[model samples]
Target: MTDLMETLIENREMVQPNHANMLESAHGGNVMKWMDEVGAMSAMRFSGETCVTARVNQMNFERPISVGDTAYITAYVYDAGESSVRVRLVTEREDLRTREREKTTESYFVYVAIDENNDPTSVPELTVSTDEGDRLRKKALDGERD
Candidate 1:
């Protein structure tokens, strides 16, 4: 089994003009792309194989992330099935100068591990070993109710 916290990963992207929408905020697609990328990374870390996106839960854009702000994406593997990994993704808008941050988006993604021939492969179970891992797992479980 793999420690759930060990699968955690974080990424940051600067919201440039090219990534912005007509409203001058980061585009929804761009944010989701980032989340998917990070979520795949976490899934791979847990599965130790090539992982492909299988499903994405409903995504909510809580707030707009303006251009020039930093987009912070955090992902972690919270559960695993025979060939699938469940990831929780959280996105926050960070003010570069002030260092302030606010939740901008959140979603859950499922990835299926694939073998060399591109067929589904089994993945180890995920384990929560520490207090932080327990808390994160609980939070992810609770977030689903919202």
Candidate 2:
């Protein structure tokens, strides 16, 4: 079993010129790529095997991260199946100077664990051992209900 909290991952990236669009905000593609990478990491942590993204559910970019701001991305395994894990991913825009942060994106990513032969493999059951883990799982479920 894998504790849901143990699989939680957080990453931060500075929005630079190369990562921004013409409007000087972080590009949607760049954000998605980062989310995918972090989501995969969370899934792998939960599954204890290599994982590949199978689906991305309802990615919403609520706001843009302007250049010079920090993109804080968080991912956690909220659910699991025989071979698949569901990860909740969220991104926030943080101002380095003011330390203000605002939610900028949210999404759910599904990943399937794979063995050395690249075949789908079973994953350990997800366990929620902490209040924070329960809260995260509930939030992910609530978002799915919406």
Candidate 3:
């Protein structure tokens, strides 16, 4: 078993000019790519095997991340099946100068652990050992219910 908290992954990227769209904000594709990368990392951490993105649930871009702002991506495994791990991903825009943050996107990603032959393999059961881990799992579940 792997503790959910141990699988948590957080990544930050500075939105550069190349990563921005016409409006000088982070491009939706760029944000999605970042989310996928971090989500896979979290899944791999929990499964102890290479994972591939299987599905990405609805992704909503609620706000724009300015070109100069920092994009904060947080991902964690909330649940797992025999071979699949579900990760909750949240992206936020943070202004380093003001220390302000605003959520920009939210989505759930499913990854499947793979062996050296690229065949799906079973993943260990997930465990939540801390209050924070329990809260995160609940939040993901509640969001799905809503």
Each model's lDDT comes to 0.94, 0.96, 0.95
- In candidate 3, the residue pairs with backbone N, CA or C atoms under 3 Å apart (3 or more residues apart, or in different chains) clash, namely none
The alpha-carbon RMSD values of the candidates against the true structure, listed in the order shown, are 0.8, 0.6, 0.7
lDDT per residue for candidate 2 within 13-129, as digits (tens), equals: 999999999999999999999999999999998999999999998889999999999999999999999999999999999998999999999999999999999999999999999
Q: For candidate 3, what is the lDDT?
A: 0.95
Q: Compute the lDDT for candidate 1.
A: 0.94
TM for every model, in the order presented, reads 0.98, 0.98, 0.98
Q: What TM-score does candidate 2 get on C-alpha atoms?
A: 0.98
Which clashing pairs does model 2 show? none
* lDDT per residue (tens digit) for residues 14-89 in model 3: 9999999999999999999999999999999999999999999889899999999999999999999999999999
The reply for model 1, stretches above 4 Å from the true place, is none
